[model samples]
Target: MTTFPIYQIDAFADRMFAGNPAAVVPLDGWLPDIVMQNIAMENNLSETAFIVRCDPATDGAEFHIRWFTPTVEVPLCGHATLASSFVIFNILGFDGDLVRLQSESGILTARRDGDAIVLNFPKQPIVAEDIPATVTAALTDAKPSATFRVASRDTDFVAVYDHASVVRDMVPDMSVLGTLAERGVIVTAPGDKPGIDMVSRYFVPAFGIDEDPVTGYMHCVVAPYWAEYSGKANVVGYQASKRGGIIDCTVDGDRVHLKGNAVLYLKGEIYLAD
Candidate 1:
């Protein structure tokens, strides 16, 4: 029998039940991919990240991180990444200030900063495209100001608008959304708030998630777009998907700086009944 540690962490939530919740499971060895997917489905949360093979002292010491949802495995996940790092540093007795991982998306890093976990992610390059039928019907009232495509693991739809309120208060037709893509849709806009440069939401029916709380991979895309539009490298961002989050980001060439806070909610062990 094999046993592992499991955690229910609230990412971007300063307190319990306020931000997005992702399950973090620490494993010493690999678990069957099917089992990991099953665990995520059982958790029924937006995302659950499994960490196997950790070595804090090694060059890539944090762990090999993977994210899963009720329906599928994802290459990148922000809240789960934060939750995983929190469990490693705070709950698992690791004292390291920085965590790095080998993931599907590529090499990623997370650092402990007082109350939050900041992530260093690659910026997804954006090139303008005409809004397609898949995008036009998903959003009801407003037409997108600009559009971009991210064809990493799956083709993603990136929509930008003029107002954050529109982005913040959007209610999508999940039934139609679910049929669109495997990666979901990201609709964003510039906020009127002086200090806040951008606001956004993520909808992924392809991944079987209606919405995501705080997406780390998103900064990879949002940062560069906002950086150019705002004419600054730094950006103050917010994800207004029901359970909102605060993300501070900046663009550096093809890389992005994603800074955000995370809180550990529950911690325990997982026994593999063998």
Candidate 2:
């Protein structure tokens, strides 16, 4: 029998039951792709992260990371990445503050900032697009004031509303949403509360997640756009999901810095027969 250590972490949260929950599994070597997918399906969380150790040392170590949803292997994932870093730095007791993770999207780095973990990710390109009738009907009740496409690791259509309530109150027709795109849509609005620059909700039926409680990937695009739109270098985003979370976003040149906290919810082992 083979046993694997598993940890469930709530990322982008200050406490339990707040941020996005992700399962992190550390591996000495790569497992079969099918096996990893099966593990993610079994976890049934928004994301499950698998990290294979490439080298071990006292300083920063390198690892190969991949993210899988219940249905598909995603190129990039934000909250799961944070959880993986937390496990490496806090739980695994890595000596250095930085961890380099090589993924399908590219090389991504996570660094410890006081109590929060900050991820350095490539900025997504945002371009104006004509709002699709199907997307509008599937995502919201009314037409968006403006629409854009997040062209990067994954293609996500962004629908911008005027108020945070509009984004918060939406109940998307997932059936229609699933059929329209390979990924899904992002519904966002200006923050209703002061100190909160923006608010958003993410849906991706293709990934087997109807709605993500908190998303770090979407903010890669959302933050930079808001920086240019609202003329703010640093912005705070609130994800108004059922289990809400907050993100501290800073847009640097060609890269975005995402800062959030993660808490360990459970630690156990998954046994497998050899």
Candidate 3:
């Protein structure tokens, strides 16, 4: 049997059950892709992050990271990246405040910001698009005023609502959502509360997630959109899932800094047949 350390963390939250939960596995070497996929399926979470330290003499990044859903691998995952960083910074006795990771999405960085971890990710591109009738019907009776498609490697649709309640109270049709061409759909609106600039909900039935509690990658899409709409460089987002979370986003030229807190929920070892 091969024993592997595994950590379950609630990302984008200060408490145990208030954010998106992700499983993080730190590996000395890369595991087989099928093995990683099976582990993610076993965990049955929105995402699982796997990390392997890069050779210090040859690589610029401290580690190489990848994210997996229950069914497939993803190009970028924000919450899981944050969770992985939490383990690295807190549990692994890493030396620095900033950790660089090489991923399919490109180079990503996480830094300590007092009690929170800030993730620096590439800003996903957004282009105005016509909302599909199927998407409109799947969400709710209320129509979105504007819609856009994230033209990045991880494609998703963004629907802009007029009110936060519309994004919060939605009970989307998962079966219909699964049929969309994009990876997922993000519904967002201007925040109704003080200190929160935007509010959002994420649905990705196609990725085996009916609803993501707190999505870090989706914020990369929404933060820039809201920044443009609000005419501000910083936008604070609230994900209105049942287990809600708050993310602070700062939009730079081509990057977005996502800041949030993570809490450890479970720490154990996974035993697998070798």
Candidate 4:
């Protein structure tokens, strides 16, 4: 049986229990797809991140990362990736404060800054597309001014709105929405809300999550899109899921810097189920 260390961490906030929680599992080497998938299902969080060695000479471990929800696998997950790197450098034995991850998304970097984990991700730049009528129905309160889509292959809309309240008042029909697009939908709006610059919400009724607390991958596309739209260099992002989180965002050329605090919640070992 493969023995792996697992961690539950809250990402995007300094205070414990205030951010999105993700499970991190660092493996000495790659596990079979079925095993990794099963392990993710067992952990049962918004996302569980699995790591395997790639080019140890580059760092200490060449890590291939994959994210899974309680129900299925996801293409990209920001918070979990941050949590995984934190565990490797902080909890595990990595010497430096940064770790490079070879993931589904591509080469990504995570840096430990004092007490927070900052992720440098490729900005999946968004271009405006025609707003579909189906998308209008999915976001009841806000109508998208712009749209972009991303699945594993083809992503869907990065729907934009005029105001945060429009995003806040959204009452999406999840049943109809869960399967709307291949890559699901991301709904966002600029926030004038106190304590935050912007507020957004995520839904992938199809991906088996009703809402994601703090989404790192979505912002890879979102930060660049908004930065261009607002002509701003930096901004704050808040995911309005029930278990919410605040993400600090900065645009730097082709990359978007996502900054947030992550707290370790639980740690233990898992023996593969025979």
Best by TM-score: 3
> Which regions in candidate 4 have their CA more than 4 angstroms from the true location?
58-62, 150-153
Residue by residue across 1-274, what tens digits does model 4's lDDT show?
Answer: 7577889988886878877889998887777877777887777678999887677687544577888887777767899998888788778788787788887667888888888888998777555566568767867844576676653346656677877777777888887776665556788887777757677888776766777777887777667666776788888778887778888899998788999888899999998755
What would the per-residue lDDT of candidate 1 be over residues 58-126, giving only the tens digit for each residue?
645567999999988877787788888888888778757887888887788888888777877777876
Whole-model lDDT values for every prediction = 0.80, 0.90, 0.93, 0.78
Better of 2 and 4 by TM-score: 2
- Best to worst by lDDT, what's the order? 3, 2, 1, 4
Please give, for residues 1-274, the per-residue lDDT of candidate 2 as tens digits.
9999999999999899889999999998888999999999999999999998875353244888999999889888999999999999998887798889888877899999999999998888878887579779877787789998886744788889988888988999988888755767888888899899999999898779999999989899889878888999999999999999999999999899999999999999989889
Q: Summarize candidate 3's per-residue lDDT along 203-242 as a digit string, tens digits.
A: 9988899899999899999999999999999999999999
User: lDDT score, residue 41, model 3?
Assistant: 99
TM-score of each: 0.92, 0.96, 0.98, 0.90
Best by lDDT: 3
In lDDT terms, how accurate is model 4?
Answer: 0.78
Better of 1 and 2 by TM-score: 2
